[model samples]
Target: MTAADFAGTKTALALASSDVTMREAFVETVTAAMDTDPRIAVVTADISAGNFAEARSRHPERVVNVGIREQAMIGVAGGMALTGLRPVAHSYAPFLIERPFEQIKLDLGHQDVGAVLVSIGASYDDPVWGRTHQAPGDVALIDTLPGWTIHVPGHQDEVRALLSTALAGDDRVYLRLSTRRNSRAHSVEGFTAVRTGSKGVVVAVGPMLDSVLAATSTVDVTVLYAATVRPFDHAGLRAAVGSNANVVLVEPYLRGTSAHKVATALADVPHRLLALGVGREEEVRAYGTAEQHDVVHGLDTAGLHHSITHFLG
Candidate 1:
């Protein structure tokens, strides 16, 4: 599928190797959750209707559309949460997190209330939209707010697992969906070891796993896959470390968002670190396909391999 396919309307399942888009899994999970529990609700900020037609038709009362008002969308979800209802709010990452940051901070964070803040277009999911739509700082912003569980699901099945877990809880949670997806589904919680090697370890967050594996195909390094990274699986990370103790964090979001956690996780052990992700030094004003952005940012497999080689060597 092309970048346009992901940016366009969400439709029937288009499975590649038995894997689906994270958004599809989200709609299915939320729809099913709402079916079993009346307290659950979904709020969208003027997104496409094709993706959520089933939920809108089946439970019009529970599914809300606040129009272009991204901030108001969060406020509405916050209000709903205060009144004994579980609200799940969504939009493109920028509209969801950047535009409505205040509402998320005050309306929900301050009130000590919780809602499931799901967003698509992670980082440069739709690179053609340019910086106005790109959001590499979404997770970083959420990091500032305490007590928020962040789930960066790599596959649709993982999206289902994480979304279901988020809805089942009352704590504030942010589920980040993206055009980038992993071919494999990791249903297990926490961090799962994808490969083991004697020369240090690499941590791949969400959709970065597939590229990471391809990048490190010839390298001797253990790879740890994280579907849910908020709580940062310290134990699994510690366990994944090998004799080299050199670490590389391959996150799909901002570079070094988890650098602190990684450093702290292996503080006792001597380790060198290289954090990789979208750069924040300047705006990538250019617009094209997601691959174009990845190429520019050195996120493609070749680039990843180069970075890993330099870091490990």
Candidate 2:
């Protein structure tokens, strides 16, 4: 008898893997969260038809298309939270976080209501759209908001995990997302050792962890993937570094990300923390596809390998 065919089973697994895009994963997560809680709603800027177009069309009644008013969208989302409704808003990183920051800080966060702010297509997803749209520093501003929980999922798996966790959370969450599929942070229910660097470590957040994980085999290195940025897991971090650990933080956001905060918390270790990210002055030339941007920021695997070798060697 001929060997039983396994092509059909393999194909279904392959298709299942391919069908889960980051945006779709987020939409499904949000939809389920909203379904479990009727008070949940979504708001979007004019970009609803662009980045969130599919989700908007998919969940029309639950999503509020706030048009081009970035600030207004955030303000209204904060208002919704007052009535005990969970409002999640999506927009370009810079516009959503920067334009409506006051509302986030004073309205939703200060008032202690559950409001979710999602910023998509961050850190150089599109070059044609140019400088104004690509936001590497988007998460930093929200990171400044004292009660805000900021999450940057560096891999597809982490994107789904973080989104689900955040949607189920009761506090204010700022989710900065990258549309590029390749770097999805490997999602674990909590945190795990993605890679290990012998001489030192790259404690990373967002999708930059992907390149770090890949680069580790080339060089002797270790990477602790920080899927949840705000309200850090200090216990996990302590366990990651048993005694002596020299580290660097890799994040897609600006220098002041959770990586920075985590590094600061490790002052007693006498370890060096190298911050790998883009800042304001450097934002001008920081425009391109995800790969192009990561390469520019020294964020790709080659760059991660080089950084590991340069620092350790």
Candidate 3:
């Protein structure tokens, strides 16, 4: 449960070339979908130009740019939704979620209308951008409003599946994309089992699977992989945990956001739970690569292994 336990481990590893980034897959999938469905409109706060260039060129009228105004971006999306158009809004994590919290609450939540709120910065995606652009609380904030289905896809394949599914629905959907990703792509929905153990269970949400695997490789615990956290697979979790009430949740967002659901699922059973994720106690303020931020926040394999080992004991 200490640094010595992870002594010779290579914590930071790269993905294969075949793997597609979540951002790339989402833009490509959505743009292609626009040709068949004219009801799909894209609204951006000026951050996703690289991905939207093709969509902008082909369907200029369908794409709306609200400059750098995050609030206006949501407002515009809400308006379009009312007119029978399904709007997909995009921006940095904080600018999209925190800056326009009220707009999302009033324009989207209050009106009972919905938009596909997609974002790139998952917590500290841009450690170089510092705290202003980071949003570890986006999911927690979204949980404030009821009926929002949140998708935290770990790979490009999952992104494509979730985006297609969300676009077809009329309810509020938040697709959280991150620079942090898993080594491989998982199935579209539900929890996938990576390993099994009898002592307890560990649930790795989206991009957290790789690190969770590295952390629990030697530990005796069932590992469950989830690409969709909200609308949390309560049944899947309860089934995986079975008689073992000891559970560990590793997510890429604010810690303990789904703690309540886990508790609710195991309410009748006596349980002890540990929640690991990005810390919200203080600002990171460090300027470096995203990996460095992972180290500081204990999301890396070494850190995660250390935490899990201690928690299980």
lDDT scores for all predictions? Answer: 0.87, 0.70, 0.87
For 200-295, candidate 1 gives per-residue lDDT tens digits of 789999999999999999999899999887898888888788446789999999999999999888888888999999887887888888888888
Q: Total clashes, candidate 3?
A: 0
Please, what are the lDDT tens digits per residue for candidate 2 over residues 220-297?
666787767777766666666666576677777675466656665676676666667765454556444667766776
Clashes per candidate, residues 3 or more apart or on different chains? 0, 13, 0
Model 2 segments more than 4 A misplaced: 1-14, 49-61, 181-185, 188-190, 279-281, 286-288
Residue 155 in candidate 1, Cα distance off native in Å? 0.8
Better of 1 and 2 by lDDT: 1
Per-residue lDDT of model 3, residues 1-313, tens digit only: 5786555342422233335678888888899999888889999988985678888898899998889898999999999999989999999889999999999999999999978999998888887777898899999999989889999988887888899989888999999998778777887567888899998899999889998898888999999998887788888888988888889999888988899989988988889999998887887787898888888889899999898889878
Off by over 4 Å in 3: 1-19
Q: List the residue pairs that clash in candidate 1.
A: none
